[model samples]
Target chain A: MSGLAPVPDAEHESVPIGSNDDVVRARQLVRALAQQCKLSLVDQTKLVTAASELARNTLVYGGGGVMRVGLVHRDGRVGVTAVFEDSGPGIPDVDQALTDGWTSGGGLGLGLSGARRLVDDFTLQTEVGGGTQVAITKWAR
Target chain B: MLKIGDVLLVSIQVELEDQVVLELQDDLAARIVDSGASGVVIDITAVEIVDSFVGRMLATTAAISRMLDAQTVVVGMRPAVAITLVELGLSLGGVRTALTLEKGLEILARRDDSRPAQL
Candidate 1:
């Protein structure tokens, strides 16, 4: 989170994650931004895949939400950042949620932990019965 | 999707939705039983991303096909997708993969030959 400059609203796009189609749109949007940021093909794929995982989590676990994606710049380095937010019941135990093979939903339980691995920076904020927000950034190298 | 000889070939040409993937799994399972196909080839040459969900779908589909006595081979994965899958910690165990559909068919054919004569 440190050293990353704030992105203007014009540079960011937000897509709703209400259904399966929204998840696919979020992935496509992230891929477009990653490519525009000049990230390597591998990096772009990783970021896009991570975004897809998070978007699905927002829809399935979070009970529908929105994903905001934008280009980030830090000290001559460029990156793509995606944030997923939801108003559904937040996670009660983040540590357990981040652990591999732990899932509250029917998924294989790899979405949260696996998305963290694919990105350079990952952060999560949640409050039980309130809401949740997860942000991830992948810098070009 | 098409049936070639004793194998079912499925080429994914568009971005996959979660529900769609689930439906595909059920459909493939039913098709395997109905067609009595011994092999299933899923081509992902046009797919650009393989997330945890899609990865799980592939594994689950393979497992379902296996239960029906069919070998499943996923082919044509892009290099970037492979790297991402590894980094994401999804090895997609239990799902066999090949570089091309042709190679996948060959593997299945070999497996079919190696199976002991049906009693």
Candidate 2:
């Protein structure tokens, strides 16, 4: 999945995750793009749910951020990618943050790991004092 | 929302935002106490996705209802949502679910019948 990029003229949108309503909008935007990608119903639901988790993390843990979504094509296969960037206290332990049922906030600790499981590709980049950026993609079968 | 017999019904028809979900939880808890209802049925037929935050709200609402002496049943979960939820690793062990609103009410009714009569 590395080096793959969005189709030159495909649709792209960005939604800010500043509040709960923004999170809902992010989910709606991802759902629409996933539909445009012609993902199956199950795949669409998975991608939207993953987006929801990440958007909430951007708001609750990251103290607000933005989600950028686009449609990517590779090898004749179409996919949707969402990138969540937040400039909050970066995760000190990426591995622990990805562990199931491990949370630094008042959550079920399933956000990061669970989102990873629902997508085709997942990437996490963070620094102790910098920020966190999570990129995920779901390709249509 | 509706009240039928001793049960309260909440049908979620919109995409649930985090604040709305939290408000629903608080409202349901208050309504349960005010009506002294014995069962609560939450219908989510219109919901297309169930993230961990929403999943946690359902579980937390059920627990609150149980503490209020009311059985809570979530109904009308989409198949895709179910599949995604399992893959997301949230079984919602503390909450009860049914396929439809009628079945949810039935489950609540059966539980009521099985309970020993109070003096």
Query: Which residue window of length 10 is worst by lDDT in model 2 chain A?
Result: A1-10
lDDT of 1 by residue, B89-115 (tens): 899879999999999999999999998
Model 1: reference contacts kept, as a fraction: 0.91
Off by over 4 Å in 2: A1-11
Whole-model Cα lDDT per candidate? 0.89, 0.91
What docking grade does candidate 2 earn?
A: high
Chain B TM-score against the true chain B, each candidate: 0.96, 0.95
On a 0 to 100 scale, what is the lDDT of residue B13 in model 1?
A: 92
For each candidate, C-alpha RMSD in Å?
2.4, 2.4
Worst 10 residues of 1 chain B by lDDT: B84-93
